[model samples]
Target: MKTDPTRYLARLRVTPGYEKAVPAPPSVGVLIVGYRACFAAAPAAGTPIASFEATTPVQIDAGAATAMALISVERATQRLRIRTEGGTEISWEENYFSAFGDSGTQWHLLPVDPSSHGGFVIARGAWAAGGYQAVLTRSTLIQAPFAPAVVSVHNVDPHTGERRW
Candidate 1:
């Protein structure tokens, strides 16, 4: 799987999402971790969704990085789960959490210290869970007035991997 563990906050600030290109400071930065998957938001059977029974509302797996877990108002019922694996000695430290979600989603926050060259997993279970994201903070959590936007470029047939548009 792909991963971003080295100064993710700093790395993410350069992207074209924040209100200001540069983040607040070393003490604060916002990171939006997007997951790729097809979700069945509306269940056909009833109010209960089958897929949600197998997994948490939000699940995050990271390699060589400390991960911050979050959810939105829609996913507030989802139970946040986190685990770390590596040689660095995983530690569950108290952290801060705030509101995170596009339309509906509930998020949670906790500091994770993974071992050297190790990995971690954070997940939750919520049938009505919506979209979610999180970030690792050094000093304090940073809340920006603007939200990040993701743009994807698809290339039909190109070995060079250049955007056709």
Candidate 2:
């Protein structure tokens, strides 16, 4: 079975409180979205067996910055170079959101010291064959202290054009 296309939007919000602490850092930020595919019949739920991922860069502005990506998947075997501890081969037929992030730089996985920027994945779902459009939004704080970012996943019906979060 083939998976439907998914669109992801990453937004970086620079709050007023953050600005009061420090002016916008003169550097661009990076946003990453990752997908992990697991065997639909696997005994362990949400265990990854295969995967695909991508990233984009966003400039830190006074208010906000945004980035977007569109992706689709097809049913195919993904071979693993290294076998599992049990030496078992694996095949994945379903995909789900595995990770999301907003970082100070592309080289860093998370916001470094003095960056005050971060993000997280709030929701995830397995991709269904011939499914509706999936919309994923990640909102992150650029310089806000103790403020948590949000990541929301929604599915939009193709026929009725309705969104279900």
Candidate 3:
């Protein structure tokens, strides 16, 4: 599980045709204190977290299924805990990659405190029996129309592990 330390928005894909397609947008809620203080558009931190179940389960062979979870990690941990209500739970390191399958149970995790760092939510799920990449955005993309394109090059001395360029 790899996470972005500076990310605030966690986007997870809700794929259709797992058990059933989602008919409507699911309710999203956070479980962290001071969540609103940190993120304005994020859901209010609630007890037992918020339900992601739809009013009516829709089974579609076309279209798309998507959802976003706004979270604030005031406190940082070695790994972010991810668990589904009725599925497997796992912890992902800050920048390590991991894999998971689709279907079965919703998942959520939030750890907030002033002493902790930030992290991203990396999840793998199916949408219509296919795979897609989910993304988390802490800050909005910047548009630098007048700014020059910035290119970075790093030359490292193999034995010393020191930058040469």
Per-residue CA lDDT of model 3 for 43-153, tens digit only, reads 332312222222011211112222223222222123445566555545534324223322221222232222212221222221111221223232311211221122111
lDDT-based ranking: 1, 2, 3
Better-scoring candidate (TM-score), 2 or 3? 2
Candidate 1, residues 64-127, lDDT tens digits: the string is 2323322212322233445465334333222222243333332333222222333322222222
Task: Please write out the lDDT profile of model 2 over residues 103-124, one tens digit for every residue.
Answer: 1211101111111133122122
Clashes of 2: 0
TM-score of each: 0.21, 0.20, 0.17
Which residue ranges in model 2 land beyond 4 Å of their true spot?
1-9, 25-29, 35-165
Stretches of candidate 1 exceeding 4 Å from the true structure: 1-4, 10-67, 70-73, 76-103, 107-109, 115-118, 121-165
- Decoy 1 TM-score against native: 0.21
